[model samples]
Target: MSKKKKPSVLIYTDGACSGNPGPGGWAALLSWNGKEKEISGGEPDTTNNRMEMRAIIEALKALTRPCRVEIRSDSALIINAFKQNWVGSWIKRGWKKSNKKPVENQDLWKEMLKAMKPHDVTWTKVKGHADDERNNHVDGLAVEASKQYQ
Candidate 1:
């Protein structure tokens, strides 16, 4: 008898901001092998960037096995950080930004990296509200969550 390989996972995430420094929320949808899981949370006072990072972290944490992950997000901060190799710089330098300040959302970033260590992830940037169904749905969920929690 041999163990069957786990299915690959796809995740879409969106983070909402009521105000730049106001209420914020994050939403994520995880899908694998015909199963879907939606997760979300909000902070009474926060920024969209943090929520965006949190969404990715949460989605990665929810996986049951090491698998391929496709993560979609509309957040430039989160997308750029990965796409631009900024996280690598931060990690290479002990998680400090260019100015030696602790990277914003370091806790979540650390967790995300750890969660991702056992798997492979590919990040895709989706334009918000531009007919990207999964991203839009997650965005709506984040918005609703922010409104409810604020």
Candidate 2:
């Protein structure tokens, strides 16, 4: 038997925080089959990195079925974790970094991994606040969402 090919999806995400550990927001733009959907949410108290991870998690969760997903984000923390296999290392080390410190945002990281199980996911690092129209759009959405909590 052969497996059915999953639908392809492109997601661009961004996160913003009014103050570190203060109000924060995350946004994602999902594109599939010539259609696009934007989703965003905010937290009264959260870190920027948490919001970044949240954006990814929420986007993946929104998919009704498994897909071939490409996620673009400006966050090095999120990008490097997968590209550099930092998440794998941390998991092997019992969720601790090289310096023996507990990984920050472990909760979200775990949630993201679980949400990713149903799909084939790829990551792309996009230049933030630059000329990338999609990236800028998500950034603006995230910033505006953050302001709501202010």
Candidate 3:
């Protein structure tokens, strides 16, 4: 018998920080079928990159089942990590970078990898604070969520 295809999901994510290591927030907009869901959270002390990774991890965790997911974000760090196989290299090197230094946000990277295992994920890079309405909306949500900790 032919296997059934997984549901296709589109997710938009963004992260904001009031002061780099200060209050930070992450937001994600997930769309599937005719329904859409928005999720967001904040941290009292976090970096923008951590928040960015958090957005992706949380979005994937929100999925009830395995899916074909397309994630759009303005974070080149997140996108390039997968596109360039940096995560694989890091893992092979005992979580160390090419410079022989420890990778930053290694914890979240592990979480993200776990969250992604159940799905076929595609990463798309978008221009932040640009003309994309969805990107802008998610950015606003992230910024607002960060303000909650202020």
By TM-score, the best candidate is: 3
Error of 1 at 150 (Å): 1.5
Tens digit per residue, CA lDDT, model 1, 1-150 = 998765689999988989988999989999888989999999999888888888888888888778889888888877788889899999999999999998988888887789889788888888989998888899999998899767
Could you tell me which 10 consecutive residues in candidate 2 have the lowest summed lDDT? 44-53
TM-score of 1: 0.88
* Candidate 2: residue 10 lDDT (0-100): 100
TM-scores across all candidates?
0.88, 0.98, 0.98
Clashes of 1: 0
Model 2 residue 131 lDDT? 98
Compared to the true structure, candidate 2 yields what TM-score?
0.98
lDDT of 1: 0.87
Which scores greater on TM-score, model 1 or model 3? Answer: 3
Name model 3 segments beyond 4 Å from true. Answer: none
Winner of 1 and 3 under lDDT: 3
Q: In the order shown, what is each candidate's alpha-carbon RMSD?
A: 2.0, 0.8, 0.6
